[model samples]
Target: MAVDKDTVAGIAKLARIKVDDAEQEALTKELSNILGWIDELGELDTEGVQPMTSVVEVQHSLRKDVIKDGDRQDDILKNAPESKQGYFVVPRVVE
Candidate 1:
């Protein structure tokens, strides 16, 4: 699970990140430590453990789907500085 400088450099190139020699050396050690920690987790015994999304139980309430058009055109237009029929009026940008 050891990470060398060349591997770090290759990873940096793939990720499109600029990693100098000093940064590559530092990242190599950091990545090696992370891989070592992951290897340590692989040694844990969990034969009968069930996979869980969360530590606590969650229940979602279901509601009936209703589709209706909101007829509040005046209410929405009140926020606009200028509305020509029912649309916002903007200054012409094109010549």
Candidate 2:
């Protein structure tokens, strides 16, 4: 995974980033080093390893689903500036 200056330039063009000759050289080295580290990680033995979302064990508590209309019309309508027939009264938008 050795990144060359031409590869760095192509990447910069695809990303729409302006990279001068000096910056391209620097980025080439950086990208090569990062890929080399990834290659090193690929060589490690990962047998009998379980993939986990978190290091600590967690138990999620869930409640029973129950649906019911909230019977608080008068209490809710009290907060409105104006209400008529158990509904908020707003100015007519259409002529």
Candidate 3:
């Protein structure tokens, strides 16, 4: 795909970037070079190749799920700077 000056100007407008008339020519050439490289990559053969998330082999260690929290309300409330009616009190913001 060839990137012209008008195409670069359109891209600049869409990205909300201000590109001067002098800079547009340089930018258009740079963008064209990048696209040419991408086109070269598309010509590679990848028959029977498996996609991988990472280069290294890894396994996650997991534990069994269990419910606990066994009644420690008074112990938790002791650390609070301000508590009211078994709950931590925060400063009111809304009127």
Q: What is the lDDT of candidate 1?
A: 0.90
lDDT, candidate 1, 1-95, per-residue tens: 88899999999999999999899989999999999888886788978998887886778779778867688999999999999899888999788
- Local accuracy of candidate 3 as per-residue lDDT tens digits, 5-92: 9999999999999999999999999999998888886678878888787787878778778866668888999999999899999999
The models' CA-based lDDT, in order, is: 0.90, 0.91, 0.89
Which residue pairs show collisions in model 2? none
Candidate 1, residue 20: the lDDT equals 94
- Kindly report which residue stretches of model 2 are placed more than 4 angstroms away from their true locations once superposed: 44-95
Candidate 2 residues 1-95, lDDT tens each? 78899999999999999999999989999999999888886787888987788877789789878776588999999999999999899999789
Q: Name the better of 1 and 2 by TM-score.
A: 1
Off by over 4 Å in 3: 45-95
In model 1, pairs of residues that clash are: none
TM per prediction: 0.46, 0.44, 0.46
Q: Which 10 successive residues of model 2 have the least lDDT summed?
A: 60-69
Question: What does candidate 1 score in Cα RMSD to the true structure?
Answer: 9.7
